[model samples]
Target chain A: MAYSDKVLDHYNNPRNVGSLDKADQNVGTGIVGAPECGDVMKLQIKVNDATGIIDEAKFKTFGCGSAIASSSLATEWLKGKTVDEAMAIKNTDIVNELSLPPVKIHCSVLAEDAIKAAINDYKAKGSTRKPAAGVEA
Target chain B: MRYYEALGLEPRLALDAGDLQKRFYDRSRQWHPDRFSTRPAAEQRTALEMTALINDAFRTLRDPAARAEYVLSENGLEASAQRGKDVPADLLEEVLELNMALEEADGAQVARSLGQFESMLAGVDGQLAGLFAAWDAAPSAGRLEPVRAALNRRKYIANLVRDARKTLETARET
Candidate 1:
């Protein structure tokens, strides 16, 4: 099947295709997969400890072109956004952005799930750590 | 759908190849369109439909993995494409590392990884066999969760192995 221009664009020049230090207390990691198609995606975020804003986002995906594109777009949208704003990012918006076919809609769902999982991980860890560098002790 | 019932046999995963073949042929004979040539239109249509269903059931039940999926579907547990998102963190970390090595490896390295992946898949298959037995001993929803989880892991391993094999094939060509 022919891929949409947006999908092809992202696939060829995928954004944020890397990993953060998963062991870092300040970094949140989200690893997701679709067993039916054997697609796995790992997305990570580093959050500003005090401001509650995402400082950086990265992703690595093993799947079809659409899956890769979906995750690439997700990371692009995640960076510099507040956790609440990131949470509001929905799979339907992603589907619309990529013009994903019905069959490939699950790829978008996976992306949204990875974003939420990462944010949740950040929240769980962000609570117990030292405050941001600029924050008062 | 009971694949065994569709073929008029008992529902057992350890079905004998000979018995399965015999049952399939016997069932086919009963639904053969040629035999229905003299029957009315509705009867002929029914025979054709039954024949198709029997063929599909036999094909699925003949393979271990496909048969397991069919059994899962029968128990109202449809395997979703999103099922692997919940794998344990440690396993996910290991798989990610393994994938990275595979992607960067050369011919010899890929060959070595193929062996490792095959062994890993074998271990998963062993686990699946145990789950299958567990399900057979007591076919309940509670037991099926582990079975489904095992199947999800197997799916991941299967894909990794497939990618490794493909890389090896390309290496050979070049």
Candidate 2:
């Protein structure tokens, strides 16, 4: 079947297609896969430490056009959004945007899941950091 | 259950091929549409359905990998395309690199990568064999988790091999 125009557009011009520094405390990396299709996706978000807003997002996906498009669009929507707002981005919206068929719906699901995983990683790191010992100048 | 019952056998992963063939032949003969011509229309329809089911069951059960997947789904541990999540991290990284190679490599490079992927697939299969034995011995949901995970790994490796071969073929055709 022919892909939607949006899907093709994103596939040909995938935005933010790279990896962030995963070891950075301010960056959260999400890695996910679909073993049945041999697809893998890695999404990362860099969040400002004090403001809780995402400053940048990047993704690397190993799959079909729909998967690449899905993650590419995911990163595009992530930048400049608050973590809470990003969490609200649903797979169905992506499906509608890309006009993904029922078969490709899982691709969108993978994208949404990657977003959540990245946010969780970011939160986990914050929680694990040592608290401030005292007031500073 | 339907397939095994149709063939007068138990649900088993290690079915004897000769026995399965004999059973399939016998059932096909009994349910053949020609034999039901003289019967009522309803009987003919039922016979047609049964014949179709028997054929499908035999085809699925004959393949070892398909049979394993069938057994897993039957036991509520379905190995669906949608259920692929939480793959081990190191393997995910390897898959990403392999995908990049497949995109940029020529026929010779693809062949080399294909060999490496095939070996990885074989290793996963060997691990699956051990897991299958463990599950067959005990047959519990807990024991099935590792088997399911192994199957996922096998599926990924198998798909990569298919992709690499396709890329090689396409390059050759050009």
Question: Listing every candidate in turn, what is its Cα RMSD in Å to the true structure after a full C-alpha superposition?
Answer: 1.9, 3.0
lDDT, model 2: 0.86
Question: Can you list each candidate's DockQ?
Answer: 0.63, 0.61
Estimated TM-score for each candidate: 0.93, 0.87
DockQ of 2: 0.61
Worst 10 residues of 1 chain B by lDDT: B81-90
Model 1 pairs in collision: A34-B81
| lDDT tens digits, residue span A38-114, model 1 | 78899999987677789999999989999999999999999889989999999999999999999998899989989
TM-score of chain A, every prediction, order shown: 0.94, 0.93
CAPRI class assigned to model 2: medium
For candidate 2, the TM-score is: 0.87
What's the distance in Å from true for residue A76, model 2? 1.1
After TM-score superposition, the amount by which residue A47's alpha carbon in candidate 1 deviates from its true location, in angstroms, is 2.1
Residue ranges of candidate 1 with Cα displaced over 4 Å: B81-85
The fnat of each candidate, in order, is: 0.61, 0.75
lDDT of each: 0.85, 0.86
Q: What number of backbone clashes does candidate 1 have, counting pairs of residues 3 or more apart or in separate chains? A: 1
